[model samples]
Target: MEARLSKETVLKLSTDHKFGAEGNISTHKVEFIVDSDFGIPGAVTVVNGYDNEFFLESITIEQNFHFACKSWVQPKKLDPEKRIFFFNKAYLPCETPNGVKELRERDLMQLRGDGRGRRVCSDRVYDYDVYNDLGDPIMGDAYARPTLGGQHNPYPTRCRTGRPPSTTDSKTESRPSESELIYVPRDEELEDTKQETIDQGKLMAILRNIMPAIIDKIMGNEEVFDIDHYIKESGQSEFNSQLPLSRILLNLGGAVQEFFKFDPPKTYSRRRSHFLLDDEFGRQVLSAFPLSIESLKVFPPVSKLDPSIYGSVESALKEEHIIGHLEGMSIQQALEENKLFILDYHDVYLPFLERINGLEKRKAYATTTIFFLTKMGTLNPIAIQLALPTGNPNTSSKQVLTPPKDDTSKWLWQLGKAHLLHPHMRYTLKTNAISRQTLINAEGTIETDYTPGRYCMQFTSAAYKDWWRFDMEGIPADLVRRGLAVPDATEPHGIRLLIEDYPFAADGLLIWSSIEKLVRTYVNHYYKNSNAVSSDNELQCWYREFINLGHPDHENATWWPKLANPEDLISMLTTVIWTVSAQHAVLNFGQYPYGGYVPIRPPLIRKLIPKEEDPEYSDFVKDPQRYFLSSLPSLFQATKFMAVINIGSAHSPDEEYIGGRNDVTSWVGEPEIIDAFNQFSMEMKSIEMEIKRRNADPKLRNRCGVDVIPYDLLIPSSGRGATGRGVPNSVTA
Candidate 1:
């Protein structure tokens, strides 16, 4: 039999055997029939069947035969010359295939390189095939050999060759490309991107938190930006090292500045202590105390008490609780009663009195008078009358004074009367005993007197003289005698009487008497009847006979010269005419009359004296009475006094008057009356001064023991209008 060589066999022989001649017969040919499943037609070759055979030429194997070929009878090794042998299948008999018919050339051609055939070849070659069965290739018949140039397998020459046969039979699975296999870099790179976003968010948050703080810093309120330091310190940490601390702080500061740019400038106030001992007072007191003493020769004594106690005393003095003991009492009594009252031992009184006297230089006598009267309580009645303009009783009335029914009226009237009688009286009277009873009725059951303490009396030297000499020569005696002069019996020929005896004990008696006499005289002169005779019978007779009988118009009748002595009437009439003519002259000619009714008074006598030494005295000498009496006319002209007296058959008439006319017309024309009263006041004031001077004689002064210098007296003229603007002077008379 001839050996047939497959392509695999050839490849194996080529690889295993060399071309060197060893032992083979010449001109030998071997042929093998292969099944179609084995290979393609040209793929097989003929070769010695045994390993000992060799040939010099290419061997060929038949496409569909299975046979063996050898050159020697026994598979001998031939010399190198006999190695090439030819085995011709044509010489062998044509026989049918024994077991299974071999494939033909064309069929073998179809089987070449097929995965099924390759698999069969593997099975036939090896007892058990390691190659997988190829039931159906995954890539179907279009499978191509894998190429190494790309991603395909390089070893396998067919599509199904590299894959396991079962894999190929299952289903086609998609292989991933390079890009799909490469995953997103999720470790450090992704973390970095996420961290960057967080850092940006954190920066924005920090900026928002610190913006306000920066604004405050720029506004000069550094405390508001205290967090900036913290932020800087925080930024220095490793975690925040990259943060721009200075830039961020600057930005925040700028934002703050912009926010507060419109704010007003800050104001700073130096602290001050209200304590008087502080720096301000220390300097002031030191300078003032020394300078004041040097200038005025007066130093307020410093107390020996502790400063705290001195402070308390200062406070008490400021509050008026430490009034000098002499305020509401006679100087002698104040000196004696030191323990009963808080005294301003500071001796402020003399200086105050000097100040008051200085005011007199400025023609501020009214003000000075008011100050003294107020301190002494003598101003109370005037103050009360002013406050209740309608309630006060008539100043000229002799009737019992009746106060209003109201408690306030009663209290005020009593207080005013007490103050008037005794200017030093302090306690306000309480007529409502229930009020005092209530106090006594309190839980303590203590007994307390409703009346206040002992009353103090204050009187000017002039007042004392006038009051003491009432019966002897003052207004009381004058009024009691109905404008008559009386003799002083004690002085014998020293005084003469022009009128009968009249009692002048009580306060209102003199004023009332004067008012009555004036009313009687004027009414009698006008009505042609005796004003003093107002009995019902008398009035009836006069009314029927004189008034009702049209023949004699009694109501309009004038009795200018009938009732009074001609000389006295002429004198009175002359005084009135002179007063009117003087007024007319001043008004019309703008100058006073040169001489008329000049009295022989001291003021006038002083004016006539020649003063060569003092300028002020020279000026006074030129017109001393004029200087003193310049204000008197105006004062008297404004006087308004109320009177209660019998008139027209009634005990008292409702008629009010300016002077004496019962007609309302007279009341309406009060200015003239007031002017007359003011002039009279000036005369009275001159008289009062004379009286004081007379009483200050050596004899009287020796009798009084004390130096009887008149306490600066203020004789309030009746007609001068009230001081303190329109407020009635009587309000605090």
Candidate 2:
């Protein structure tokens, strides 16, 4: 058999040979000829490496290659040493998180999140149509999708050649092609695990495992997907009401998925997630949910929602109501004390409401939820105001929904919180996904999601534009931006949070500090001082291109500080590393745990709160439970979305969690740098236990509320499948 090894293979001998000496062992030898063009060895001659009695048969070789683990300085071409390691337990074909053994190829055809999926879109790269978005600031005069010339559109086919393939020749018109039944890529092509096959087999697998169980145990053909369904009997606590949440956190939940990826509620009959969404504890716990509430900030916001127009919801969030929750603290006092924090979605959704509401069975409000930090350090929801842009950007109508004084009001408050989080789930994933190649592999999700038409990109772009705060991808910097913390020069990381019990921030700080220390050590090892940082041409050039070319729009933005000091370099490098590993895990891996349940955390909510004048009002009043279900995605739509998030939440067999795996024995780096990373690994090891302790602590209600489940999203390690924990080192989903 004729066999060939192009490059990237090696078989070494234990005995050492002198520099430039031929490989020799008695009568045996091994020789390799280097490829001149690429400077890589291609031909190897293992000439009788064994005894003369043992004949040399054919020499076989295989090499696994992967894209470099993304640091800010990712290699443009393949670099073997920097390659991310992945496992292909193809033997365990059914071993998928959420039990989705195979994927829905037709449904998820263009939605794959890896190099293989990118290859699928290689031909029908056009999106079946053009989006001449007149308001696109990047293009100045928009005439194309990002795939043509937008963000993360690596191939600018239009720019390279003045025209792209006709928009008419895309999507359905181009005609779909069949895909292989199984994901049978070469041994080297293991990275394409998520979406090589082109059918709904994975979706079918997920539905068969988890989706039907919901109907069988709770809903029982009720035709509704509501948290209330979790409760099996009257007055039963939500804690013991259902087991699927565990099945989701366990069976269906991903054990330790690499890349990508909600809570809370009302009513005893409806089932409550006290740890996730209690009116007082769970709602505030969600402030640190890490999905949509990253927008939470000290209220009255540093800037008003709809600041461009006459945007103010201050009237709706009354001082009396807020002060009632703040004990003796006045609104102004809480603001000064950092006791008041707001997750305001008003400014973001208002501009696009008119267009978004027009989409079929879809409607949303620009919402603002206010939470007051209690004496015990848990956040308590004071007021939630839902607003609608009154057809004018300048004016919006707002109505406040407070903690339930009655039953109608209880579900209303629940509805408000649900809507607050629902709209931003995909956006949060997309924004973070776009933050790093590692944040979320949810690359094509925005386009391929269930949202109607161009509105998906429009909504996502609005979120990105609104959320583009000038902060490093660090929780400390984010907290500072959100006014959740003050910059304290004396604090270890140079910042201290106002709310000490904050789960995501508190747990994240340890991870963040460890990472920063590692970066400082790594950068300081090479550059002795500011002079070195400034003088390094390669470093300076990389930074220049990173800004000028990578984010050209913000190249000259005020936040782009001069890279002249080692400390500055440390900050830059740490941001890159954290964004890829821990930060991305916090954002990505927990999708199925929270979103998998679907009741407490719906991806989208369709109807607005009904009034007497509305026709749906009578129906809502008659059967609020069924009305709410009607507002949610139908069973099929909801289950299909479940499958999407489930797929995003699972890990491939060969997973690389945040700590480099045991197999990664060495890297080409300074001894001190390796030591720093090892230190980081040690610190990361302690994090899971620390988090477990906090969850065990009765004082932290947000984490260990009325349920046995605690916030494990920040847990640094996860097993295979959807385990609701672990931070993958790379974007696996």
Clash totals in order: 48, 29
Instruction: For candidate 1, write residues 1-733 as lDDT tens digits.
Output: 2233443332243445433343432443444455666433322323334445332233343433323322121122322221222222211112312212233323233323333422211111111111122112344543311211112211111122222233444332222222331111111011223234334433443444354445544653212112112111222322233549986676666554444221110110111111111122112111111111111011111323233322211111111211232256643343243212111212221112223233221111110000111221111111111111112223210111223345433432332222211010001111111112222221101111101100001111112322322122223333334322334556322233221111111112222233334434443343343433333233344334322231121223343223233333323333333222221111111100101111100001111111246465544445443333331112111010000000000111211112222222222224444455445435444533543453354443211123222211122122211110110111111
For model 1, the stretches where C-alpha displacement exceeds 4 angstroms are: 1-523, 535-679, 695-699, 702-706, 709-714, 717-733
**Tens digits of per-residue lDDT for model 2 on 245-283?**
765455333322211111121212133434234444344
Candidate 2 regions exceeding 4 Å error are 1-29, 32-164, 167-288, 291-315, 392-395, 423-453, 469-471, 662-670
Give the whole-model CA lDDT for all candidates, comma-separated: 0.24, 0.52
On TM-score, the leading prediction is 2
lDDT of 1: 0.24
Candidate 2 displacement at residue 322 in angstroms? 2.9
